[model samples]
Target: MAGWAAAAALLLLPLFAVQFTDGVNWEMVDFSVFGAMLLGAGVSYELAVRMTGSSAYRAAVGVAVAAAFLLVWINLAVGIIGSEDNSANLMYGGVLAIAVIGAAIGRFQSAGMTRALSATALAQVLVGIIALAAEFGSTAPSFPEAIVLSTGFFVALWLLSAYLFLKAASG
Candidate 1:
């Protein structure tokens, strides 16, 4: 539940940042959003493993998520169904890959440690938002617009994370 809430907050961050300043780039925003989602997944996975005391299940879930991310990366890399912006595609794909690696590590390591790492991931998202806001200055009307956009985005992300967490927890 906490993990989902964190992810929800992260998803809203980009829109908020964007509304505050037009200078925000999609790559950075996407990186932050995906990073948060991955972090949430790790947290949920760690909790599940801790409760079940089964490393096999942890590894299985990690691998499955990683494999799915890899497929998405490939699709984006090849421009199969979306924009062909190589830089954005590569940036997003690399971030997802890193997340997968982190998940893999979490699966094999101590659950408590993995949970800590997941918390760090969530912190990174908040830090990114602060950095973006700082860079843009807080004087503009766009600041409010950004906040609204981010709120919506975060809410959606939170719901998604919560759903995923519940599903993973139950399984």
Candidate 2:
């Protein structure tokens, strides 16, 4: 209840800003989506906490869920190192979507964990490569080093998550 209330309060912050100043301008749809994302993150972490017994697994679950929420929210807000509408950035969402769906499909078993983690890691790589390609194809005059760095950063995170899952599965 505290988590949900805190998330709700955060979501309402922009609205309060709008009432007092012009600096904050967010549409209803923006509020709805962002609110949903926050709520979803809280719910996910709560579920992970309830379902997982191992501390390592719980930590991984917490991080992975938070990462997915952040990745999606950032891409939706400002794109993953580029324009928000850039299709190449959708791969981040794809990685997360697979994580959820793959878990369900695998019945949350050890072998399934391995496959799902590997798939997510692969998706992260694909996101980086595609984002790089998208940047090159754009008519924008100069390349942004930040884009490359961000992609590399995310790829490393996914790889680490995969390794964690593999270790958990083996143990």
Q: What is the lDDT of candidate 2?
A: 0.71
Error of 1 at 117 (Å): 27
Query: Against the unseen true structure, what C-alpha lDDT does each candidate score?
Result: 0.46, 0.71
Writing each residue's lDDT as its tens digit, candidate 1 over 1-171 gives 675675578667766887788876557657764675567566756665676555444554454454444435344434221233423223334434544566566653444234423433444345335434554323444444543353344333333433343344455
> How do all models score by TM-score?
0.29, 0.78
Best by TM-score: 2
Q: What residue pairs are clashing in model 1?
A: 8-158, 12-150, 12-154, 16-146
Scored against the true structure, residue 37 in model 1 reaches a CA lDDT of: 52
